[model samples]
Target: GAGVSQSPSNKVTEKGKDVELRCDPISGHTALYWYRQSLGQGLEFLIYFQGNSAPDKSGLPSDRFSAERTGGSVSTLTIQRTQQEDSAVYLCASSRFLSQETQYFGPGTRLLVL
Candidate 1:
């Protein structure tokens, strides 16, 4: 019954560096999603993966952002050439599917780019 989890909980990085954020989603979840939330802002969908559906990467901010999911359970988001504007909480969530069901979220990996 392990829930979603993210490492460090917080990260500080210099501008133009690279950072990798990890996410462990709940077991048996076939749908995984990556989202970003700025201070006081609503959640923005970044990418999503379902059982056999092609990964959706429409929300990726730019070329510097990429993500991959292995075994359909664990996912990692890598941000290259980090920018001050990238400072935000990178959140990961998973649900039975992207529908009426609620998507459980991890505590989040907070990135502070300076």
Candidate 2:
């Protein structure tokens, strides 16, 4: 793809349900990140991955939210036992090397937990 792309542009799930959001980053990008933005709020970082390893996950709001990157490309964010607070736009971004570089963002997955 030309840039980062995410699957299921919109997802509606019930409370306590599990959801998996997928992101395919730009080719050759080494760093990937997961984020979420709630209504009327700033973007909140969730996780960061260098290659296939996640070194920074301090931003995760709860243990129910977990992410993984495989083959340094596609990444998945799994939200288990979703709650209304978890309803937000799940965003994915990728950079050339590290977090300091410019990041290309995907369209984002809109997750609505009711």
Candidate 3:
């Protein structure tokens, strides 16, 4: 595959609504990650998945946020009960392995929770 691809590049939702963001990682990459970047802030790790094992979701900001990787290729992030402060660019990245190496990132999904 060329690179990671995210759907619905831009999303706008009313407060208290729910939304789902999708990511399609490059083929053969076994390590995937999700991150969020708020305006005027740095990227924050949200979750990570390695192979078929349980994802490392310690970085999720709250219980309202969740994600899942299906078949080790595509992943989706769901935000329940959205709030204005939840607006940010959700990013997805993937690497061949979970080692000290460079990771390729997607263009990111810009989410706006009004």
- TM-score, every prediction: 0.91, 0.97, 0.95
Cα lDDT over the full model 2: 0.94
Which 10 consecutive residues of model 3 have the lowest summed lDDT?
Answer: 49-58
lDDT tens per residue, model 3, 16-67: 9999999998899999899999998999999888875545678999999989
RMSD of each: 1.6, 0.8, 1.0
lDDT of 2 by residue, 2-101 (tens): 9999988999999999999999999999999998999888899889999999987889999998999999999999999999999999999999999479
lDDT string, candidate 1, 10-106, tens digits: 9999999999999888888888888999999999889987853535677899989998888877788999999999999999888987678789999
Model 2 TM-score (2 dp) = 0.97
- Any runs in candidate 3 off by more than 4 Å, and if so which? none
After superposing candidate 1, which stretches have Cα over 4 Å from the reference?
A: 51-54
- Which of the two, 1 or 3, has more TM-score? 3
In candidate 2, how many Å is residue 39 off?
A: 1.0
User: Which clashing pairs does model 1 show?
Assistant: none
When sorted by TM-score, best at the front, the candidate numbers are 2, 3, 1
- lDDT, candidate 2, at 29: 98
By lDDT, who's the top model here? 2
